[model samples]
Every structure is written in C-alpha cells, then in structure tokens.
Target: MAWGLAEFDAERRGKKEGYSAGLSDGISQGIQQGISQGAQQKAIETAKNMLTFGDSIEKISQVTGLSEEEIKSLIK
Candidate 1:
C-alpha cells in the first residue's frame, strides 16, 4: 500500500518524520554541549592548579586557552 506524502505528513500534525528526528537532534546537541562544558571546566581547574605552582598568567592562558581576566579571577 503506497501512502501519499501529504497523508504521511498530515498524520502526525504535519511532521514528515514525526518527533523522533527532532528529539534525536536535540539529544545530540545536548551531549555535545555537555562535553564542551566539561572540557572548559577541566581547563579552568587546571589553570587554578597551575596558579598554585606560581605559573605566569601568560603561560596559564596559553595552556588553558582562558583569558587573562579569567586567570586573574582565580587568584583569590
């Protein structure tokens, strides 16, 4: 039984592939955001540790990709 494109689209409130594709895309984007957040947090922690070792702000920024202002904020 061949189904018409219009019929398939109309079946689910005009969603051509239903909500699963959108849901999956959302989940994928969420995972990527989480990973990026975690990596940034880890870099900040590393920079803090480097500060304790008397590392220069320039060096810390180079190693962590954090701005000088961000590195200075960790001083206290």
Candidate 2:
C-alpha cells in the first residue's frame, strides 16, 4: 500500500541521517585526539633536548608544560 511504502521510506531516511551525523562526529573527535597526541609528543621531545643541555626538571616543566615527574621519568 502507499501508506506502508511512505512509512518505510521515512524510516530508511532517518537511519541514513543518523549514520551520517554519527560519522561526522566520530571524524571530528578523531582529529582532535590526533592533534592533542601530536602536541604532547612534540613537548616530550623538546623536554628531552632541554634535559640533554642540563636544564632542571622545574625549568623543563615550565617551558614544556609537562610535569616535573614526567621530566624526571625522561632521564631513565
């Protein structure tokens, strides 16, 4: 019947829209996480270089935004 076809079509459209929205949100979150991880990695590398140059843990922490504990761990 016409009414049954219309209902089926509406349901299908709703599912497609939901899937698209979810995919978009997932992509955005993935990008944000990747950026955060990259920044953290860069900070760690900078801290290591500073350590090699005899920088104090507190100084490295201040400059790199990493904790003193993290800088100390890098010595190992």
Candidate 3:
C-alpha cells in the first residue's frame, strides 16, 4: 500500500486536533470543580466563625445556606 503526503498529513492533523480538544475540555471541567470546592470551603469557614461569635443557628443557616443540622455540628 502507498500513501500520499497529503493523506498522511491530514491524518496526523486530525489526531492532534482531537487531542487538543479533549485536553481543553478536561482542563475546563477541572477548573469548574476547583471553583465549586473553594466556594464550599469558604462557606464552611464562615459558618465556623459565625458559630464562634455566638450567631444563632437559624441566622447562620440563613446567611450561609447551610442546614440547621450542619450548623449544629459546627458548634460541637
């Protein structure tokens, strides 16, 4: 079997493009996951601080969007 230069180049280009697209998608997903985790950690830290300052569970839950049960756990 004989292959021409154009055919070989086209196949190589397709493989490289596919790899680039997959890598970009994976990185985007990773960044979104990181942002979500950071926000959650920040909220928990704020809740802990509120608990320290004698904030009521109902108020903290309203401000931090944490459940009453979760806020109770934080005070422990």
Candidate 4:
C-alpha cells in the first residue's frame, strides 16, 4: 500500500511539472506575439505619419526600419 501511494505521488508530481511547463510556454508565446504585433503596428503608424509630414517612402522606411515597399504599401 505504501509503495502504491508513492508511485501515485510521483505520477502526480510529473503531471504538475508538465502542466507548469506548458503554461509557461503558452504565456511566453503570447507575450512575444503581442510584442511583435505592437511593433508592426507602431511601424505602420510611423510610416503613415511620415507620409503626412511629406517624407518620401524611402525616408519613412529609413526612420521606421520598414522596407520602402512596405511603406509604399501602407500608403496605399
């Protein structure tokens, strides 16, 4: 009976560890995806603002770290 209880405890601990790992991975992925999306949005907005300021697409790309083609596509 004692041995059976010990084996059950070990299995429970393993499951807990697996759950914690999966949760951590999910949270990390969500945070990174949010950050990447935010950066892309900011870049696009910056390009649009530069357009309003009469800057060329190339200049916007330089300032925002976006490609010229991306800036042009945003403008359209």
| Candidate 1 deviant stretches above 4 angstroms | 1-10, 13-16
lDDT of all predictions, in order shown? 0.92, 0.96, 0.91, 0.90
Clashing pairs in 2: none
List TM-score per model, in order. Answer: 0.79, 0.93, 0.82, 0.88
Clashing pairs in 4: none
Tens-digit lDDT track for model 1 on 1-76?
8989887768877564668789899999999999999999999999999998999999999999999999999886
RMSD of each: 4.5, 1.9, 1.7, 2.3
Tens-place lDDT per residue, model 3, 18-42, is: 9999999999999999999998888
Question: Which of 2 and 3 is ahead in TM-score?
Answer: 2
Error of 2 at 73 (Å): 0.7
Top candidate, metric TM-score: 2
- Total backbone collisions for each predicted model: 0, 0, 0, 0
For candidate 3, what is the lDDT?
A: 0.91
Over 1-41, each residue of candidate 4 has an lDDT whose tens digit, in order, gives 45688899999999999999999999999999999999999
